[model samples]
Target: MAQWFTKWIGWVRVIAFFGLLFGLIIRIGDPQPLETLRNASFDFYHQSKPRELTQLPVAIIDVDDTSIEEIGQWPWPRTRVADMVQLATAQGAVAIAFDIVFSEPDRLSPAQIAQDNPDIPPTLLSKLTALPDNDQVLADAFAKSRVIVGQTTVRTIAGNREEKREMAKVAHALIGPSPLPYLLAFPDIVQNLPALEANAAGRGIFNALPDPDGVYRRLPLVMSVQGQIRLGLTPELLRVATGGDPFAVRTNEAGLEGIVLARQLIPTAHDGTVWPYLTPSSRSRYVSAADLLKGRVPQGRLAGHLVLVGTSAIGLEDFRATPLGVAMAGVEVHAQVLENIMAKTLLVRPNYTIAIELVTTFILCTLVIIFAPSLSARLLISLSVVLLAGYVGTSYYLFVGKRVLLDPSFPVLATATAIILISTVNYLREERQRREIRSAFGQYVSPDLVDQLTQDRGTLSLGGESRELTLLFSDVRGFTAIAEEFRDDPEALTMLMNEFLTILSRAIMDQKGTIDKFMGDAVMAFWNAPLDNPDHARAACRAALKMIEDVHAFNAKRRREAARRRKARAGQKRKSAPARRKIHRIKVGIGINTGQCVVGNMGSDMRFDYTALGDPVNVASRLEGQSRYYGASIILGEATARALAETFAIMELDVVRVVGKAVPETIFALFGDETLARAPLFAALCATNSAMLQAYRDRQWDQAESQLAEVSALLDKLKLNMADYVEMYSGRIADLRIAPPPGDWDGVFASTSK
Candidate 1:
């Protein structure tokens, strides 16, 4: 269970890293939460340090409450408006723009009054009709001055008055693809009266679009109205003020870049909108229309200044929310737009800023994922704080120094989330590793070793590491024939095999060995893994001897039980005879080898085992197989024998090459422990065995036979069974006598089977 979690920990991190990046990509669509965060940051920037009103090139001719009271309400006669226009032109104003649209003819006009009142005398009506039309008078005044009339876009036309609507005349020099697809479109426009629109030098739309929070931060400089492109009131005012020929709209595949007027470029957002860095509403920027008309305005106030005429009366409902958290007159917004542009203080969020923000966020989040697991909690928190501060600091600096808007909220949030998730995964992985260590090694190793493994987890590299390990492989000899005794009762066979394996496994665990796995009747184990054991070779040899001794005890107990069962069956009645069952003695061969190997968890990510892999492990299995051929209970490779040369009674078996190996390995057979090694009889037996092997290698068949008999006699004296060893050489010597070995024979016997 721990292995399963351990393998997926890395996957979890990868998934989280890319998952956060995908979320950042989704944020590019500007979901509500992310947009709110970004907008709040931008709002805070403006609120903290609004644009300062340095030079007032733009002035508002506000029709304030005082003006409304002084001038007798709105919708005043066109003659009165014409008089104000004439006065503004006489004051040397460069351009006068109306934020209010004169969409209908003045009802106070003399001709309209005449038409409304039919009861008047025919001669009086004729005299009134002979007087100049009020709209015509306003048109004459407009023609005499540089005036820009206002228009507004609507979603739908109220009635079938489209034929009477006048479109603004704008010359556009496009540089790339058409911007119609990228602009805010409206089906119709509320145009000024034909006379006022035709006489004006320029006409533009006065629509101030608000953000989602209903705050006017950015205003469109260009828009699509009735399938035609038209300039905003402020941009048109600049055009007339500079006398620029045509607007050079720069664009690319990514929507609008900027618009050029009089060779001066004005950068805009993708939708051709410009963010007006607004100042606090100041009374100094406004002059009452009553004051202007009454000759109360200062002399130079209107000189060289572009004036915007609009109503600020509360009854007009022209107020808008600004980023400063205050409601401002809509006309004042236009005046501020012109002021910002003319003063070169407009805030710009370039199109590439989004791409830059996304890339930065991804990189930051990736860094968090990569480092969060390794760093301490305190260090991670400090780093996160630094990173967040850096983002906000850079954004604030750009906003204050460069007048550029870049939001840091999303990056901060994303990086923090990555850190949290990756740290959590790391924590869980460590916990799992601890559980795995305790669960896997609790019974096999000592408590101190388990504690060491748990405390120093870096040593438990599941990916693998090369180490010198003493590997042991053991299998039941002739297990197929043994199993035939219980073929009709498989449950009994399972019980017998479980008991037999338990004894062997306990022997290995007693010496702090790791059980790699079991292959039916075979058991594979290794030492000097997961924890260091300098005496691993000696420990493995001891385990092998212990397993053989335990098996012999198990056989004695089984024989006693079988004999007791037979006595009970014989005493039963003849008509109720018990079923007869064959009993087999359990014998095993163990092989031990010491060499360099890679030991760790090995398998697929989903399922893996802590085991060792190398040629040494395979050689151990082949040595165990050769034990049966030599009639020995245990066998050891040259490395293991060399380590315990004097510690145990070991005899050289042969110099034979195992399957899959080109080099011959010197093999040894285990007889007993140190007590037997010091025994005089064992020393004599070893001398005889060495002489027999020497004579066999020298091709002296007669002397080899005589020495083999002496070796058998010593084995009988020691009460040991090794007839198969004597018979194997006897057959080999006979074969060599019949067909002598080749001249190049080096006394090395290469095994043909595993």
Candidate 2:
């Protein structure tokens, strides 16, 4: 399992790399969500540090509420508007522009008044009809001053009336490809009356379209009206103020680059729009139209300043949302554009900025995916913080120091998202490994040990270490015959094996032992290697005793079930063809030994198992085989017997040399726990058993027989079936008496079979 994971780990990073590329692709598309995020970032920059105002070259003549109250309601007769133009011109203003369009004839004209007031006397009506027209008067005022009339575009022409279109008086020249296709286009325009437009020095469209978010950030300097290119109000004002030179529009393959006028290059976006760096609205830039008309404004207050005439009255509904989160009058927005253009403080997002942002995002996200797994989590977080800070700082520097608009939102958002995804993947992967570890070892060891290994993976290793371990081997005494009973039904055999193994495995795990493997009907287990256990010998002994007790209970239950089946069959009326086969009871022999052994994961690199290997392990297996010969259920090696002698009911079984070794080992039999060991009955039996073993080894046949008779009576009292052991010793003493032993006789018994 470990080898499989190592072979495929690199795929995770490769997937992350492609994911970052997809993010970059989405950035290039500039979806609405991403655009909104970028716009918000730019808004924050503007709000934090708005454009600084020094000496503004433009002034707004606002038709505010005061002006409406003092000068009567709006559309206050073109003659009154003509008076404002005359007054501002008399103040030595360089040029004046209107943000208002006079699209209709004046109803206050003498002729129109005469027609409306038919009830008046004929003589008075005739005299009033002969007076000069109010519109004509306004036209005359325009002819005397440098006035740039404003026009606005409409989406549709109202009614069926054929509208007359008047072209602007200014000339336009192009330096490259035409910009008409890239500009904002409209079907119709609301232009001034022919007389007013004809007398004006220049005509420009005053249309301030808001962004999708209803915020005014960029204003178009050039637009197409009815298939013809027209200049904006502020650009017209600049041209007329500087001797009305022809507009020199520069273009390239990407679209409109900028507009050149009066030897000054004004940068613009691809759509011929300019991003105005705005300051908060200030009263110092505004002069009340009421004050000017009433002769309250001082002289030279608007002199040398390009003046804009527009209404700021709330009733006019000309206010627009600004990036600074303030509502500014539409007319003031135009004035700000003029100020920005003249002062060269306009914000510009160049065509290459998107490229720079994309490259930065790609590079940063790629680095995150590549290094996030190898680096510690703390280091990764710190690096991400530094990178994000640097990106924000660079963007802010460009915005404030260079007047450049480079969006930091997309790059930072993309990189941060990448980091989160990579970190999440790593965390999930490690969690899965931990779960695998728990699943793999949960059955072999106690839950506490499994949990410890899961929490601290560093403790796990794939190599061996030498340590003192108690090894156990348990096997069904008659497994071959048991298999023959279920040879026709292999599934039943499998189920029987699973049931017994589950019981034995539970016993071993309860003692905090690690199961090595299961071979056929036998189970091998060990302790004190993966985790330390000073009482491993006692634990192994306890497990063996538990196995014996549980197996006895299991066999009793099986015998009852078998008896019930036989009685039910006998009660049936039908005759059986042959008697049913007898069921066999289950029993297991356990052998335990304690010694220093090398224990760890052992196998091929791709597959492995945790097990122990040493001479002591071999001796433990040999003792298990020797159990059937001694008619014992459990046998323990000398080392393990000594460890448990004080806490368990153990008896010395024999000192024998097994088939594989030359040295003899004293093996003991385990019957019960400390309670049984402290019983008086067990103590009496132990004394008689010791005397019988000593008499037999001394070659005293008559005394050995007498002691053996007492030992058999004591074993019967204890309900132990060791008659085969007593008979074997009886036959050995009889043979020794018939044929005298050689002088080199020893008590150590040697077995010829394993």
Candidate 3:
């Protein structure tokens, strides 16, 4: 029935393309924490992947763009942030934070609330209860040191709208009675007063509030405060910088679960707010509220460094959106939660991260019952890169060595819904066996392995898989004397060797190369595997310079069909005899070598052929038959010329020992391009091939026959190729110029045959 309504309109266009990517990830909302840390650094290089520097610095003082061009806007007043907490407790800073919310008071110098009440009237109701009480110079720089401040959180509903806030809590801030009735009181914005919350040692409630998809991931650590649970200042400032518990919180029924400090539990999932802290704006940390009200910088950059101040200016929208971007700075998400608890990453989620997503969808229905229909988009992308690096390396090793919280977004959405139900049963068996080997190897290889072999075609092998190769050998230079001048109707030599083996099999399948047959016109290919490539000598020197630039564009279209058959027989060619043209300036050569041969499926199990074999594949077909006596159109051997060092342009050429081997190596000369070899007689034939291979590895045969007689007088004054390896290096420099032996020779010259 019209293929079941085109497979139900292609599964309703794949469920409306993941419901329009979950409604554009829930129409991007949940921001604020300096715009979710400038959209988590605009999703650092577009939505996470860069974990890089072994990932752990945890550094944020960022009100960014150099703390808003060295601090000023976004609410900068509390006696100019009490001289940036006395210049971050004189710079050796390990902790000085604030996502901001001094809560009122400092209406900017109405004369510092008459010296914070110096006994009498400086009146208009004492300056009308005289403003500028920038929280007693921020509680005398929060009584000198380890500062952290910020408070704001709200959530209420039950009965005649009892939402009333008048915040300034900390007097005897304890709550231990436990029944977990959500509360966190204090905030008609008390803007700090009771002696700046008794000279503040620390405080944290920046309330990270995300989850309408603007993604904060999670960080609410603890929530309720007046009926129970109170924690927050990023687990009480990483439990007061590792000394532990400014007040511990442990509740049960898995709500405010175990946020430890010394005992460690710390890995977070944040929802009740607290998650903003990220860093790196500079190590001069966060000084400016006008350079700490003019005492200029330095006291060891504030003793212990968690230092944050808010409003990274752009008119203080406090930016947001983090996994590490928008512009970054909701106090660097508590400086990425004190550099993720001093570098513990603390992002994990696998407390059996939903039982490892039901055992990765029961091992994807046991690999669709062992490769249904016989899988092979390269074994379903090598089993989706070994089940995505074994489930993101077992959730990044339970968040960097068991800190924990492994839910890698629902086991990466149940491994993309079990690789989309084994790729919709491998897209309904490649749409019911309609195989053109996935449109003939989908323009050769990757389309994510052709949509993982059209989702999973029964773990494929299609009779081609073997290993142990090193083949390559090119031809052309007078192809057997140009096919002995094409004999009579050899059907024009079978249509010019089938249009030159279809232009050398489409330039060896456009460098994704494989061809192992064409010997009549020479072509043999090999790399990592029938399909792997671990940089096979840079994919066989980029498929021999794309088969020598498609044989110089098939000898420039047979020299424009032999100049239009000599201008369509200028003055009538004596019948057919004049057609003896189209030799098209030959030049194919190319040879390469590397070992460990034998790669995949030999012919005859209903004619198979994946190809590759050994003896470095007949010494790369005897260095492509010594490239027609060395005018070389690309040759290599000293182990594919020292396994391609600094990617090509070699020279050293020859030490012979060919025609079925006996160790006499040195040959090189892929030729030209060390930026045009360095001119001056190709830089003295590369300094007489490094002083005649260090005087022929110190056997010194008359300083290797005076560096092979100045490399045969610089290849006869640079017309080049001093043929047949220049009298095979002057007959091995006259048999080592008469019986010379070696001493400490490490110039490994060994290769006696094919």
- Index of the highest-TM-score prediction: 2
Question: Model 2 segments beyond 4 Å from truth?
Answer: 1-9, 157-161, 444-754
TM-score of each: 0.55, 0.58, 0.34
Every model: Cα RMSD to truth:
33.6, 29.9, 23.8
Poorest lDDT segment (10 consecutive residues) of candidate 1? 157-166
Give the alpha carbon lDDT tens digit for every residue of 320-387 in model 3. Answer: 66655444545655556666566665444423454554566456534533453356666776776677
Candidate 1 lDDT, 141-195, residue by residue in tens:
9999999999887778545564655575679889899998998887788888988
**Local distance difference test, candidate 3:** 0.59
The TM-score of candidate 1 is 0.55
Order by TM-score, highest first: 2, 1, 3
Candidate 1, position 147, lDDT = 93
Q: Model 3 — which ten-residue stretch has the worst lDDT?
A: 170-179
Who is ahead in TM-score, 1 or 2? 2
